[model samples]
Target: MVVRRCLVLLVATAAHVGCTYDFDAFMPSGAIDSDLVDDTSSGDAVADDAAAPLDSAIEDVIADANVEASDDVSVETSADTSADTAADTSADASADGSADTGGATDTGLVDTATPDVPVSCPDPEGKALGTHCYFPLAADNWDKAKAGCEARGAHLVTITSAAEEIHVESIRTGKDRWLGLRRPAGSPIGEGSFAWITTESVTFKKWGGGQPSGAGECAVLRAGNDWADLGCKSPRDPICERD
Candidate 1:
């Protein structure tokens, strides 16, 4: 029994040297042994110290994320406000332009007058010349040509200006054409004394050389684009004029 007790004490001493309490647990319940308690406070302190840096890093990440989110929201709000302002400005400008156009229309500044539509020549064969229509007729005497022109609701062509004479010259055939000029009773044998069949005033004349010569009553448009008196019975093509 003595040897066994000595061996058990040797084992407990060895176990205490190894920093274990397995052998100390067999002591009396009321006995206080300082080395019997496992001192884990130092390990827990090390763990807490290690976790602080990670926690701080996590807090910094969260703060940065919150700041970035705030910036994004602010940018989006500013962009939306700018877009709304531009839209309003565009709408206002369009409204002003429309109002201006309406005001112009109301003030009669817009030319709403129907544009003058030109009247077409009455006869399909009639050629439009200047402001009138001209029809070159077949060979006929002055009286017959006058009658033909009246039948067609027209008058024998009259030259009222040099421009009109140029216009008539453009359509001159190879032969002379009868004009509407004739001498009236009590009239002299001069260019001024002759009158158009339409009774228009004798405002212009192109008598050839020194002629009226009282050669005949009626006049003819020579191929050289001048006028000469001729007999009323002579056969010549006539040019008819109308609006």
Candidate 2:
């Protein structure tokens, strides 16, 4: 009985050994599970990191777009301001130019139309004759007397007719004054009608009473105030009339 019991015990022990689980294989399985879990975690972390970088890039693009818009607005505003300034400057210059031109024209017009006034003659050396104001030249040859009067811007007194000559003779002042009358030597007596050399006509005349009849063809005024037909070369004071 004891031997049989020993044999059974041995067989049972061997079978147990043969049916026992393989520890090495179990360990390898557990290790495989751990590696899978680690790999999955690492992949998840990498995905998260890539997503963050993409978001950052999107944000940078947005910021750049905003900066460009601001710069464009500033440029447009500056251009507008400059244009307004230029327009104002042009208007002001035009106004100033017009005003200056008008002023210049007015000045030019005013300068061209003013008239000159006449001057008055000085007095005392010569006496005034008639209401018309005549001056007498001092005694000189007839031609010289005439030239003297002309130099003073006057002409020898002109006598129109015999009646005017008579009238001039009435104002005698007791001196042999020159008359416009002149008789060339050897000229006929009555044939020479009295006339003024300046006017070349018998417009005014004055003769002393019965004066220019015959031998008195050559004549002189009795006073500085009278008129008579006289010799051409006779030296005497002459009267000058201002026009």
Candidate 3:
């Protein structure tokens, strides 16, 4: 009866407290009971059932953490990719700009349209002679010849030395040519009264024999390579000179 009452008390306590115990494992071998052993097995089954939900909760937390980590990594990768693309674009633009600048520099350094020509003679057809240019004009009167020479920025040829006289005489076409020498009206038939039309001082003279018989005011270089006075209206080819 006492053992039966103790058993009844143990069942009452277990129902009231909602707790479990390993009754058979703690009991002495002489006091072991089969019903209590069955209760101990049931308690172990409840403990395992309670632990299963905790394990599932822990697994759920781990899975959520893994998902968040994956999202962070994806964000970082996307940001890095964008930065790399921007950097590459900037670099490419810089390279293109540098290439364009270099091309412009190379093109600007060279010019290819103009050429070189001689600088001594202003008239392209004039002959360059001993530091001057000489050109022969068509037959014209003295005043007209002087005007023509002035129009072309030149003057009638003036011979100042025997060497120049010889040089010009060699190039003459054997035609009577007008000289720049002229005599002022009412002046004597001497060299002192003559002046070069170009205003150059008369430093030399090679008059032909018995010349300046006071024919006129203008002078001429005769075909025989000597100078003589003549009428200003006489037609003769003009020799033009310029430095």
Off by over 4 Å in 3: 1-119, 122-125
Ranking by TM-score: 1, 3, 2
Clash count for candidate 1 is 0
**What RMSD does model 1 have?**
17.1
lDDT of each: 0.74, 0.59, 0.78
Check candidate 1 and list the clashing pairs.
none
**Which RMSD values do the candidates have, in order?**
17.1, 22.8, 13.5
TM-score of 1: 0.53
Q: Residue by residue across 1-243, what tens digits does model 2's lDDT show?
A: 443333333334434344443434544544434444455445435445544655577689989999999999999999999999999999988788778796343444445665744434353344343433356668577878878877887777665556545444543346676766666556666534554566476554455576676654445676644445665566677766565
Q: What tens digits encode model 3's per-residue C-alpha lDDT throughout 1-243?
A: 465346545544554446665655755665855665566556445455555665677689999999999999999999999999999999998788779897343445556777644437656346766677787877589999988887888888898988878766765779889988999888898767788876878888999998877998999999999999999999887888876
Which 10 residues in a row give candidate 3 its minimum summed lDDT?
Answer: 3-12
Put down candidate 1 lDDT per residue, 1-243, tens digits, no spaces: 453334344444444344434534755554533432343334334435545665677689999999999999999999999999999999998788789887343454667788756657767456776568877777578888888887888888888889888777766666788877889755688887798877789899899898887878888889988999988888988888885
Top model number, lDDT = 3
